[model samples]
Target: MSFTRCSLFSRQSSSDHSPSLLFTGLRWTFGAIALSLGAIAAVNTIITARTPPMGPRLNGLFGRYPARYGDLAYAIGGEGPPIVLVHSLDPGQSSASWRAVFDLLADDFTVYAFDWQGYGLSDPNPEGLNAREFGAQLRDFIRDIVGTKATVIAHGSAAPLVLEAAESGQINGLILVCPDGSAPDEPRQTERAEFLAQKEISDRLLEFPIIGTAVLNWWRSKPNLEREAHEFALWDKSQVENEARLWHVAAHQKGAQRAQKALLKGRFAAPWRELWKNSSTPALLVWGRHARGFESASEWGALRPDASLQVVENALLMPQLDAPQEFAGFVSEWVKKHTE
Candidate 1:
C-alpha cells in the first residue's frame, strides 16, 4: 500500500504541482531580467566609448552660421594686415598645430588661426565633408571675419584648399607648407591617375562604420600618436609626450572621425599642380629639410617660379612646431615684403 501511494504522487500532473511550476517560472523570469540588464549595460558601454568629452582649451571666438559649415572656432590678435593660418587635415591636427608660432606671428601681423569644420572646437558637419564645401566655408570665413583680402598660410592638406580660394581671388597671398598633391615619383599623368585610384580604394574601406571607426581609433591611439609626433611632427623627441597627450585628446572628440573618414574617401583630392600653375597670387613655399612628398624643392619652385622658397633645417613636416623661431621669422619677413 505505501509503494502504490508513492508511485501515485510521482505520476501526478506536473501542472497540478504548485512548488515545481513556480520554481520553473521564477527561473525563466530571472533569466530574462538578467539578459535585459546585460543588454542595457552593453548599450551604455558603446555609447560611452563612442562619445568622448572635449576638454577646455582656448579657441578664442566662434564665428556663426553665415560663415558656412555652421560655426568656426578662431582666434585673432595683433594690429597689422590679416594673416589667416589654415591647419592640416590630418586626423589629430587642428588650429592648435600652429600654437607654437601663433603668438610670434601675432606680434607682427593680425594672426588668425582657425580650426576647420569637424576639428578642434569647431562644430561638426552632419551633412558630409567635401573639398568644395570646405572651400566655400573658407571663402565665407574670409569674407565675414577677416573682412578683407588676407594672406593665407596653409599646411599639408589645407594647401589645396587655399590654392582653390586663391584661384577665386579670395586671398591676396598664399603660403604652403608641406602641401599634399601629386608625389614626385607620380608626376606623369598616368601615374597620378593610378595614385588617385589606389587612394580611392584604400580610402573607401574607411567609410565602413565598424572598420572605419576601428581604423581611425587605432590610428589615433596613444602609441601611434607618440610615434607620429616624434617622427613626423616635431624635430625633438622630448616634445612628443606633451603633444601626444593633446593630439589624443583632440582625436577623441565627437565627430572627429567624420572628417577623417570623408578625407580618406578622396573628398579633398584636386589637381594641385594645375591650381599651382594658374595661381597668380604671390606665394611662399616653406619646406622642412626632412619633409616628405616633394623630392626636389627646385621642381616645386618651378611650378610657381615667381614664388619664394624657404627651407627650415633639421625640421620634419611641421616647421612651425619644430622650429618656431625660424619659421616665424621667415613668415614675418615674407609678409612684410609682400604686403608692402
Candidate 2:
C-alpha cells in the first residue's frame, strides 16, 4: 500500500504566524521528508531482494493479523488468562521473545504475543505508528482479541504501551521484563548519549518516506538482520545466525519501525508515569543483572505501593533467554499468587 509522504508530525506552533503560511510550510516539509523516506525504502528493497533467505523455518513464522488499520502478522500458541508479550528492540526477538515464558506458562494461561508493528510477522507502518498510538491499539486488541481484564507481559520499549493500557484500568495484571522507560540509578554518560543519538536517527528516518522504507528493507536482510539480533540478544558480532533472525523480523513486520520511532522520541514516558502513579494492578518487574533498566526497576519498585522487582543473578537484557527455567517458574508463581 502506498502512503502519502509527509514531514515528521508537527505539534501546533505558538508563533504568531498566519495559519495558511504555517500550513503551507508544514506541507512542504512533510512532503520532502516523505519523499526522502520513500527513496530510502526503494534502495533498501533492492538490496534486500538480492540477499538470501534464512531458508524455510524463518519464512514460516513470518505471518499477518487483520486489524482495523491492516493485518498484523504475529506468532500465537499455548493456552488460560490471555498473556500478550511485547518484545524489545533487539532484532530476531519475535517468538523468541516469549520462548522461555511460553514453554512455562502455556499450560496455565493462554499466551498471545506478537511482534509489534514492524518486528515479527506484523506489517510495516508506511503511515507511521507512534508508541502512544500503538499502546491504544494494543489495548483495543487485548479487549477485542484476548478479551478485556487479561494480563499483559512486555519487555524493553513496549513496556510503556503496556503500562498505559494497565493504567486505563482495563488490564488485570502486568509483568515487565527489563522495561526501558524508567530513570536509571547509575546513568552512563556515554551510553545514554549513544542511545539518544540512535533514537534521533530513528525519529528522523521515520519522517523521510523512502529512508524509512529502505531501512526496513535492509533490516530484513540476513547479515544485516542477524547483526540486529545479536545486538538485541547482547551477543558478540560474530553470531551470524542470530543476526539473521533479527532481520527476518524487520523484513516481514512494519510495526517494529513505528514502535522504534515512538520509543526514541520519549513518547511512552507520559503513559509510563500515569500507570505507575495511578494503577492498582499487581506488577512484577524482572530485569537482567547487567541490563540497562535493571537499577531503574529496583528504585522505581521501592517507591511504588503494589510492585515487585526481581533482578536476575547474572544475565543480560533478556533474562528469559538467559535463565529460562528460573524465569518461567518465577513468572508462573507470581501469576498464580496474584490471579488467585
Number of the top TM-score candidate = 1
lDDT to native, each model = 0.77, 0.63
lDDT of 1 by residue, 10-80 (tens): 66666677576568779999999778656655654464486556542533443444454567878886779
In order of appearance, the predictions have TM-scores of 0.78, 0.68
TM value for model 1: 0.78
Q: Number of clashes in every candidate structure?
A: 0, 41
| Tens digits of per-residue lDDT for model 2, 1-340 | 9875433224435464457666988899999988876776667666546544332122113345666666555555566766777776544455555655675777677777665654555655444455556677677777667665777788876776777666566777788888876532333886887877876777786666565555545544566655544555443334447546544644444345565544444554544665666667888888877765566775568557578877786576777767778887888788888863
| Minimal lDDT window, size 10, model 2 | 53-62
Please state every model's RMSD to the true fold in angstroms.
10.6, 12.3
Which pairs clash in model 1? Answer: none
Task: State how far residue 328 of model 1 sits from its true place (Å).
Answer: 1.3
- Number of the top-ranking candidate, with lDDT as the measure: 1
Instruction: Please give the lDDT score at residue 11 for candidate 2.
Output: 41
